[model samples]
Target: MPDFLLSQLLVSVTLIIECGAMQLKNKNYILAALSVSCFFNGFHYLLLEQPTAGYIFLFSSIRFLISIKWKFQWISAASLCVSLIITVSTYIGILSIIGFFATIFITIGSFSKNDRFLRLMMITGGSVWLLHNLLLWTPVGILVEVIFVGSSCIGYYRYYVAHKPSEP
Candidate 1:
């Protein structure tokens, strides 16, 4: 198969996995699903010759899995540091910087104990990722980020907004 075709396939699979992950109620389950999605997404970026984005996604897969077991601030800090290293080492351009910040938001959110905050961070990261995908001109990636952000917003509203006590 052509590299473009395969890249699209991988990102499509990532889209499916991420969409499902957004609906998950448990943090561990969400991280598990995101880990798989990030692996596929990493390959998708590599196939497209975006090494910086590719490595970041690959590292994110591991980070998400580790976060499931250890939701510590230090772990989150370490993940950010590693992401920075990956970005600097594989620096492509401004996109690398954008990808780094996006990863930072997602990494911090992943390590948090609050589910609502996680959803919010996912939305924020997804927005930044959307820009990166748009610039890359990856149709599936752009679609996935749009859906990811939308789903996160819906999840946030469903779980947090709906459950909030009414104002007196």
Candidate 2:
């Protein structure tokens, strides 16, 4: 495990680069994003016999930043999928397809003003990322991840129905 100081430093750096995590005004969101980055970086450096997997987090972060900086949602979406797959491939010996589902949800959610749906997608993606983390080293993490995703799914479905256009 990374020392508390190192993790705090990493979180601080990520918060600064992501503009104090302004896009994610909620502190929880910022913490989640930074923590995910930390997990990937830590995994690559501490575990993993080869250590090439850490770059996946960097690529994903860059892609995420580009979307916010340049407003390229598609690029961000693609990068998210790529990063998810890279991380999952390294850890999981089996396929779960959570990345694919999350990406599709994100891509669809990105083109609209459905903030609720977008949040759901982000939460779902985050949950999957957590699950992937658990699958890699700690099997107990999946239960928590599932609860988080499930709660968000309810909100998402509600928004999807509310925003849905009606027939003529």
Candidate 3:
């Protein structure tokens, strides 16, 4: 298989797992799927020679695993510090900054208990990633972001709009 196709296959798997995660009611299951998604996403980025983004996903996968037991504060603090270092060291351009913030947003959002907040963050991060993919000239990455955003929107509608409490 071509290198790009293989990379896209990894990203495709991540997208499928994310779709399943959005449909699940259980937070643990969602986190587990997210961890796997991160692993595949990171591997895909690595294949594309985007080491910073790849490493961020790898780090996020580890974060998700630790967050299965650890508190949010610890995770956020560690993630912010690591993100800063990676961003500075990578120093590509606008995309690096976008990647940094997107990673942080996704990291915090993934651990949130509020469904709306999580989806909101996902949308925000997905937007940034969309731009990053465009700049990086990665068609697969762009497609993944579009699909991810669509999934997040559907999940948000189902969880927040369809199930909203009626006001007294």
lDDT of each: 0.91, 0.46, 0.79
- Candidate 1 structure quality by residue, lDDT tens digits, 59-92: 9999999999998999899889999999999998
Model 2 poorest 10 in a row by lDDT: 44-53
lDDT of 3 by residue, 18-37 (tens): 76676665556666778888
Instruction: Report the number of the highest-lDDT candidate.
Output: 1
TM-score of each: 0.95, 0.45, 0.88
Better candidate by TM-score, 1 or 2: 1
Q: Rank the candidates by TM-score, best first.
A: 1, 3, 2
Off by over 4 Å in 3: 165-168
Q: Which residue pairs show collisions in model 2? A: none
Model 2: per-residue Cα lDDT at residue 109: 39
Clash tally, candidates in order: 0, 0, 0
The TM-score leader among the candidates is 1
